[model samples]
Target: MPRWHPAILLALASLQLACTLLLLASEQGGRARRFLAALFTSEEDGPFDYSHPVDVYTNLSAGLESMGGKSMRDPVFLSPCPVVSPLLVGPISVQLSGPVNLSIISRRNPWVLLGGRHSPPRCRARHSCAVVIPHRNRELHLALLLYHLHPILQRQQLHYAIYIIQQAGNQTFNRAKLMNVGFKEAMRDEEWDCIFFHDVDLIPENDRNLYVCADGPKHMAAAMDKFGYKVLLAGMKISRPSIRLGRYKMIKHKHDAGNAANPNRFTMLAQTRRIWRLEGMNTLNYRRLSREQLPLYTNITVDIGPSEKAPARRLHG
Candidate 1:
C-alpha cells in the first residue's frame, strides 16, 4: 500500500471539514450563508453573492414571492393543518376562569376578526362566514365569547367576521329584530357565503365543533355544559346565506333588567314570532346607527338551564 505524506493527509482532513460545513450552511439558508461569507470574505469582496443555490433554495422553501423573477419578497404560505374536516371529538370541560382581558387578547391575536372581518393568511378558505351577534347589555360575556371564539375560529381556519348588531335603545332588547338587522347589514356589507347566528353568552367547550355552515340550518350547541351536556338548539345556528335564524341568549342576572325574562319579554317574543312567521327575515327594517345612538351596558351576566324544552320552530323553509 502507498503511504500518504503528513501534509497531504492534513489537507484532505481540512477539505473534508470544509465540505461538511458547507453542507450544514446550505441547510441553514441565508443566515448561515451570510455568517460563513462574512467569516471568509473581506469587505473588499463587496456584498455576499446571494445568487447562489443556498439562497435560491431558501427563498423557494420559504414560499416567498419573487418580484418579476428578480428580488424575493416575504413568504405567503398555506397552513400545514387541514382547513376543514368532520368534527369527531366529544364535549370537553371548559373553564371560564375569569373575565377575558380584551386588551391582552387583542395584542396576542392581532389577526383575529377585527371590526367584524378576517380572511385567513393561508390558502383561500372553503367558506366566507359572517357571525351575527344581537346585543343589548353583556360586556363581560361578549369579551369572554370573543376570547374563546377567536382561538376556536382560528383553529378551524375559517374566513369569517363578527358583527355585533347592538340595540339602539333599551326597548325590550329586541333580539329577533336585531338579528334580522345583523343579517341584512352583513349581507349589505359584503357577499357572505354563510351566516352564523351566535349567542354571546354561549362559549363553546370544544375546538372540534366545526363552525362552518351546512346545506341547511345546523344547530351547533348540541351538547352544552349549561344544559347538563345536553344539546340546546338555542345557542348557535349555522346556515347558508339564504337561510338565517333569530337566536339570542337569555343572560342570567340578579334582576331581570333588559333580559328575556323581563315583563315585556313575552310580548316582544310574541311580536317577533309573528313577524318571523309572516315576513321571515324581511321583517327587520335595517337602520344604520351612529356611535352615539348605540347604548353600552356593563356588568352583564348569564346562566344555562336544562334541555327539557321543546324543539325550536323551524325559522326557514
Candidate 2:
C-alpha cells in the first residue's frame, strides 16, 4: 500500500543478481580458510577450537547434515502432520503440529523440568514455534529484536528466544538458514519448546502472537504496522488480501545462494548465503540499510497447510 513497494522489489532483485554473479571467492574454501586461518594461520594460534557453537554448527556438525539428509514434506491440506525423528531427543515419538491447544497444559513452566501438571500432561499447550526470517544487513534489526522481543515475551507470557545468525562471511540473505539458526539456538536454550527464527524488522502487534512458540514454529508477522500487510479475520484466515508479496516471493530469493543445504521452496535466504556465498563482509557490515530500507517478513493466518483451523503466516522479504 506504499508507493515504495515496487521500487523495493526491484532493488532487492538487482542486488540479489549482483551477489549471485560473484564467484563467491571459492565458496566453501573461503569459509573453511577464513575460519581455519583464524587459528593456525594466526602463527601464534593453537589447535582449532570446535567448541564454539557457531563454528560447530556451521563447520563440523551433524545437525545440518541430518536435516539436509531428510527430505522435508510440504504439508498439504489437513491437520498438522508429524515430523519423524530418529529419537534424537525427547520421547521416542512426538506429535507436534498446528496452532496448538494451550488449555490442555499449564502455562506456567511448560517444560517437564519446569514442573508440569503431569507427565504426558493434559496438553495445555502443544507448544512448538518456528521463526522464518529473510535477512541481510540486520545487526541493528537483531539488536532491536533482542531489545523489544525480550520484553514482549515477558508481557505476553510466551516462551521464545532471539536467534541472529547472519549470512555467513559474504553470502546472500537466507531466510531459511536464519530459521535453522533459530531452531539450533532455541534448542540450545530451551528444549522441547518450539523455535521462532523471526525477522528483526517485524514485531507482533498483539499478544495473540503468543510467545508459546505456537505449534511447529509460528509466524508472528501475520501483520505489522511498519509494513502494508494484514489478516482479514482474527482467527483462521483464508487469504491475506492486503499483504503484497515482496522480493521474498522467489523460493530461491535467499537460500539458493551458496549453502548446499538442500534448500526447499522455503525462501532460501540464509542457506543460500552459505551455499551460494552471496554477500560477505562488505555487505554484512555495510551501513546502507536504514530501518526504512530493510524488509519485514510478514505473517498470514489462513486456511493453509493441513488444517483450516491451524493458523499460518506467509512471509516476503
Candidate 3:
C-alpha cells in the first residue's frame, strides 16, 4: 500500500470542497448565486460607497431590536398641541377639477384609523371634533373635499372624524335634517367636544384654519371665493373678523341633483323658531339604509322619508 503525500491530500480535499459548492450552487439556483456573489464581492464593488466595514447582519439585528423596544414602550404625547401647529404649511393650492384618490389620502396619513378618525401622534388634541357633511348626489364634490380636508386636519393636530350623512331618496335634499342626524349619530360614536357641520362642496385653502372648538360655539365659515369673499350663510360663514381661522373656499359647483334650493327654504326658515325644539333631531323619523366605516370617513346613507311627511311630536318635553 502506498501512503499519500500530505500536501497532495490537502489539494485534493480543497478540490472536493470546491466541487461540492459548485453542485450546491447549481441546485440552489438564484439564492446560491446571490450568496456566492455576496461572499466574493468586495464592499468597494457594491452600489453604495461605504467608508467603513458595514456589518449588515449586526445592523439588521439592531434595527429589529430597536423596533421591538419601541413596541414595548408607550408613546408619550403632549396634551393640547401648540396653538399654532408646527405641522401647518399655510395656504396650500387646491385643484377643483381632477380625479381625487381616497386610497392615496389613506396612505398619506397612515395614523388615521378606520372610519376616517385621526389624532395627533405627537400631542393630545385640544378638542375632539366630529365633522358632519350632509351629502346626497355630490360624489365629485365629496371626493374633492375629503382629498383636501384629511391633510388639513392632520396638520391642525386635532382629533377628528369625518361623517358623511347622505340622504337616500330622490326627494328634495334636506341639509339641516341630515346635519341633525349626523349630530345624533356622531354622539353615538363618541363624546365629541364639538361638531362641525361641513358642506361637501367646500375645500379649505389654508392649514392655519384650526378645526378646534376652543371657546363656546363658533361659526367657522366666514368668507368664500364663490360669493366674492362675502359672508355667505348657506355655506361656511363665520369667525372673528381679524383672524382667518375657519375660512373655506367653496368648490365652484352648481346645485346638485335632488339638492336644488328649496323655494320655501326662506318660508321654512321663518318658521324655525316655531319648530326649533320639536322638529330638529327628536321628531325626525328616518331609516338607515347603510352605514359604512370606510377608510376615509364614516358614510351613513338614510331614507329620510318624504319631504311632506308629518313631523312626529318630540317624545321629550
Off by over 4 Å in 1: 1-93, 224-252, 260-277, 291-317
For each of the candidates, the C-alpha root-mean-square deviation to the true structure, in angstroms, is 20.0, 25.3, 24.1
In model 1, what is the error at residue 270, expressed in angstroms? 7.7
Evaluate residue 204 in candidate 3 and report its C-alpha lDDT on the 0 to 100 scale.
68
Please give, for residues 159-258, the per-residue lDDT of candidate 2 as tens digits: 2333344444444344443444434434544474654445555543322234443323234444332321122222333322112111011111233344
Cα error of candidate 2 at position 53, Å: 40
List per-prediction Cα lDDT, in the order shown.
0.51, 0.32, 0.68
Each candidate structure's TM-score, on Cα atoms with residue i matched to residue i, is: 0.53, 0.30, 0.66
| C-alpha-based local distance difference test score of model 2 | 0.32
What's the ranking of the predictions by lDDT, best on top? Answer: 3, 1, 2
Query: Ranking by TM-score, best first?
Result: 3, 1, 2
For candidate 3, give the lDDT of residue 180. 78
- lDDT-wise, the better of 1 and 3 is 3
Superior candidate under TM-score, 1 versus 2: 1
Total clashing pairs in model 3: 4
